[model samples]
Target: MHLIHRPDIVASEITPPDVYLDRRRFIGQAAAGAAVLAAGGLLDPRAARAATAPREKLIGVKKSAWTVPEALTPYQDVTTYNNYYEFGTDKADPSENAHTLKTRPWTVRIEGECAKPATFAIEDILKIAPLEERVYRMRCVEAWSMVIPWVGYPLSELLKKVEPTGSAKFVEFSTLADPQTMPGVRGRVLQWPYVEGLRIDEAMHPLTLLTLGVYGEVLPNQNGAPVRLVVPWKYGFKSAKSIVRIRLVDKMPVSAWNRAQPSEYGFFSNVNPEVDHPRWSQAKERRIGEFRKRDTLMFNGYADQVASLYSGMDLRKWF
Candidate 1:
């Protein structure tokens, strides 16, 4: 029942859900959408052309309350133009080299201030909540964007199931550390085992999704396969991928990027154009597959929905 949002836009402006929710219009638009699916294609030197995960398998998944009324970035673009540093720092490194990384035989250890501290099988994680599709606009810190059809469930579902203790004020996520397959592990690019965190309330927000797949298919290794977090209102880096640990604690957890350069990257990380990156203007973003740049939005356009979450705090200070 909860709706998802971008940082600067109102919920109603998201894909015309009202039209789709209507029985007659839904059928008409769906038919129209199907016909237009094949013509558009884009190639990025930063990406690759490869077979995508089975999007057909997701036909049955329920749609989330919101979507972006726009064409998706080419699947090849989403899979290859990735920021997953585990494989390498280059944009195409993930797609080209992540196959060597194993995803099966995975387990996520949940600990810290919770009634239940347990380790769950990767498959079991999928069973915790029913998966659904949310077509969201992903705005990265680098000023580029993509519209991704992510399949997952609200993060609140898992937090509730685990029963976070009252003392738990923040949630920290830790990514896998497989030096054997992840070549980037050898370099000092980032502290190994990348870590990110969210304030407890932020983690519990309805828009915070724990992603398992994309475009209806199980996740590709380069796309944070198996497991990751998708926080639509924040910059993409806040959504830690290939997670292995979820810990609840009273204090805010230090994230990799923020720790490395505290002055540039803040813990809140809400996408706000008013607050420019150290070296560039964030007022406009270059969406992948597009020739023209569009103005960036506050909270990446979800300000109306999520701004209240930080009501008393200064976004400029926190960001």
Candidate 2:
């Protein structure tokens, strides 16, 4: 019998069993602190923002089979260490600047090659399908990773409601880019209303999550409040946040990163250890709270589920 080669796992990177089990308690404590801050009268801008935009517990969050069995990153690390460029370029920028984002009274416009094209309110979108908790490994293009418990339904559930036409071959997603609310938008870091896209089939895949919440509560402003897309197989940048528009079209849409730096960022930003980023190696990644690094997995360890989508195509060429 041949042993399976598991390069992604390392002895030093293995989480202690006790630490894995205690994650729930740690999360509970974080939630308790958040609750107290939400009670009001906080001096800090961040805490005051938290008071106004309190994250409610997402009711009926069913456990999903799609979750991984690894230890989760701490709640604090996941929320604070972010790459939301619309807020700022630094890792801590989003957590500090995104507090000004207004999530309520939001609407997502669904247009293009679909039979039923219409704008849907955030509340109406939530009612479209029951929420499920999927703890997926999030790999960032910047060579960092995290295991987050995201609460959302399969994107197909909402896609089906709009009913795509035969001509719709790709799906394009656009994020909110108000300069007044999002201070970073005033600068020229990236083009306004950040855009991302996926092949029609990938958009309809069960793994493509239309995320609403994280850590069992409504998403914090920094974590892409309102709604976002989570494509587990691709790098984090491919998952557009604070989505405002979704359009189905026949032609491939130019994604924001791809348009910004074609030589660096690709449209199909799949996590492949073989294909390294121009500036860095994609072979290894450091988990947010871990000291040691682990080998990056092909398609972020979801190869069995998503590899077929790229069959017969030269990833190096498309990449």
Which candidate achieves the best TM-score against the true structure? Answer: 2
Q: Which window of 10 residues has the lowest lDDT sum in candidate 1? A: 39-48
lDDT of 1 at 221: 88
Q: Top model by lDDT, which number?
A: 2
Residues 240-284, candidate 2, lDDT per residue (tens digit)? 999999999999999999999999998899999999999999999
- My TM-score estimates for the predictions, one after another, are 0.83, 0.84
Residue 189: error of model 2 in Å? 0.5
Give stretches of model 1 more than 4 Å off.
1-60
User: Alpha carbon lDDT of residue 12, candidate 2?
Assistant: 64
Error of 1 at 154 (Å): 0.5
lDDT of 2 at 234: 97
lDDT of 1: 0.86
Model 1 agreement with the true structure over 51-86: per-residue lDDT tens digits = 333333544578887787879998878987899998
